[model samples]
Target: MDNISRRGLLTGVGALLAAGSLGVSTASARSLALPASKRFKMSATTNEFFRHKPLWGPRVMQSFAFDTPNNRLFAGQLRSETPENSGDLTLSQLDFSGNVLGHMYLTGFGHAVSIGAEAVGSTSYIWTETDADTTNGRGRQITRFPWQNGKTLTSASVTKWKPVSGASVYTPAVDQRFGRLGVRHARSDGMYINVYSLAAARTGDFSTVLASFKQPALTAGIDFQGWALYGSYCYFWEGEAYPGEPDETKATSKLWCYDINAGVLVDSFLTLAGKSLTYREPEGMAVYGSTDGTARLYFGFASGEPGDRRANLFYRNTLV
Candidate 1:
């Protein structure tokens, strides 16, 4: 398939290209039979992402989302290794096996903590954090823009939308099966997740929130990693990459579950899958609704050296 170029796209349809948001539609959200007992397990065998490498920027895969309609995976990463360029972000287009297909750049975007991917007809739009805070390289505004391969689009060049005001930081993720978009923010009191219909969020009208709940706390020193929202359940990361080589001494990454409806913590488990990876560090989490109508919760890990890193993705397609 030829990559469509929208480097000149300037609103919801033209500029940001609200792919799925152009029309009001709904798909009944389905649960993957995640344990309501808070005892989530990963008994399913794991599969790696075929050493998926980004076409540009730091090879670290910070966050990713599935372009279900296109059978593709979109990943987010920092564009540079220097501190002065930390605010820049990059998007890599890839196949489900984790092989690079194409790429684009989003300069002055946030830390690339999370990104939303939507495919409409022949166009694919990306939802991400923009308007870098400068101080810490975090995004203060959420924005959507069409994916223009080989093009560099700046925050000021695109339309910026802060779904919630007074939040110190903002990041976004998309759930294809549920047809929802979630923007997680950090406020004075605590972090919170605000979910909205994909149709409403794309148009900048968040007056009606589908779900609002406080984010679960993280381990003291664990870096806040990737996240995803499916139905009313929230899954987040709780582990960091090992410094050098990941070996027998390396720690297993932890994935936790939060029930947004009941507003409580539900499940937590350490995954030993991919324990053999080098420099094993947990990064992104995405719930992919396969073409066969089955839901798979994908968790990613970063490996290899700094300049030559590879993304190792694994998923649980069955209940544990």
Candidate 2:
């Protein structure tokens, strides 16, 4: 292996060793074998935010259907400020090399909520959004836009915005179907998975799927956000707040994965192996394909022993 691959393998091994030292148990420690091309290279845009003012930071990202064919990546930027004051939500296009190519601003929406993209036709894509206001408790509707040319996109036409009944509005991730949208609400009890038909966007029709297992009782100050879908599974990392107690029994962190279709927990992996890594706050995850066709998941943690600002990425072989 070359220097880069060697470094990556060593990092993975180190992480496992650290976990072991901390008494973290789950998967056996093994060096990650990464394809040379699949090794992650830090981008110039690696910082928390782009060139924009206030630097709200880039939170979540999803791809447009035409991205692979056209060599483009469409992602939404979640602004750190509130929507009423900031009125910021940005949609950007990036090249395969992680260079920003094109971008547009979204107005009226409080914060650019969650983003989902689907192929409506041969070369057409439908992008959807959901706001992040909890007080309203009403989920916004879906908006459709066509991504065309290298740096041009058609105007967004609002198609659906409806209040979700009998459910508190929360940030949601969506998977599109031909006639409906499968939305999973990350809730305390577990993921509240719901399927909303496209035609019923204004009505917010939903079929709920509850977590197969009981929700763990977490200590106060431990923020438990729901899981994020990567491939066919959803991964969730639960961590404690800052100034966190070091007592592992009182405050601990873990990563769990559940099969999407089966709604069952396949496995739970502890982020801290043997206490080598003390997690402060963990948030957001993404998956990308390595050059050799292997897939890896990247997670971002807010704070830890390394530092609150330090962000670490981890990869595991795709089970699917």
Candidate 3:
């Protein structure tokens, strides 16, 4: 974090304090700039199997994470259009430019809600919610995969347990620099963020909660779509999509970039309104940047309508 962003964060905190309480409002502080014209697009077809389907399933690229050291993008896909049929999960590997390199089909899981990817040298770790259903049974767990030659997926023994039930768990973000895992989800009141030590979480030791805060920006019943943590900032995303019907005019883009280190929001803005038509429901996020303060943010949107079920990835080059 630079002096400029640090000051911005402090100023935002002071404003919230003076205002008495944090409410559902935009950060009246700095605003993020429009994404650069240099953009890339990939369709559900990139995974090959999903290309010919008339209506792409509900969870097409539901979660996203960037492996900084390996320069690979990991995307988690739920093949079922509805929760009742939620069982099949696929993990796709791609490059920064939206090219699918290879993919692996993940099985032996029940209702995978979200996925977080982290890479340390040749070993890769993925955190996700498993055995969770629309009715009951949900738990957070991590898996280890070592890829030096052939592709293989193995499960790790989760020795600890701290269960959060019945809430829609969005994507989790791993902070490699700090060895922390950040997770967010929706409840009856608002959204809650949980930051856990990566070292402890890997061993299923989720005892000490580093930072737990409520995001008043979301009201009760509002859906938490996607989020990511990079450097000292955390980017949150959601959209306004009319149920069943595809209306680009009614669809909206809700995005907020917060500085977790300073405990304040840095930027808030909305885009992609009546523009792409297919860019609705922002469900996944990934940030590729450094601590010195420069990043390219990527968002994955899943389509609901049949005609618009094509490519669904968007990017913004600037941080704020």
Who wins the TM-score comparison? 1
lDDT per residue as tens, model 2, 56-79: 134322122222223344555433
| TM-score list, all predictions | 0.82, 0.50, 0.65
Q: How large an RMSD does model 1 have?
A: 10.5
Per-residue lDDT of candidate 3, residues 1-320 (tens digit) = 00011111111222222221222333332233211222211111112112211212334455667776666666666544333333345566665555566665544332333467678775666666543333322233334343322243322322223333544433356866456777665445444566777777777665766665554343122344567765456666655444444554554566666655445554555555324444345556666544424445666666545333433566666433
Give the per-residue lDDT digits (tens) of candidate 1, residues 158-277: 988887777757889897766789888776555667888898888888887777765644444345567887766778774666766556554657776666655555566667767767
How far out, in Å, is residue 45 in model 1? 3.7
Candidate 2, position 150, lDDT: 39
Error of 3 at 174 (Å): 1.0
TM-score of 2: 0.50
Q: What is the lDDT of residue 159 in candidate 1?
A: 89
Q: Which of 1 and 2 is the better model by lDDT?
A: 1
Count of backbone clashes, every candidate in sequence:
3, 11, 1
Q: lDDT per model, in order?
A: 0.68, 0.37, 0.49
The runs of at least 3 residues in candidate 1 whose Cα sits more than 4 Å from the true structure, single-residue gaps closed, are 1-44, 52-55, 81-86, 247-252, 290-292
Candidate 2 achieves a global lDDT of 0.37
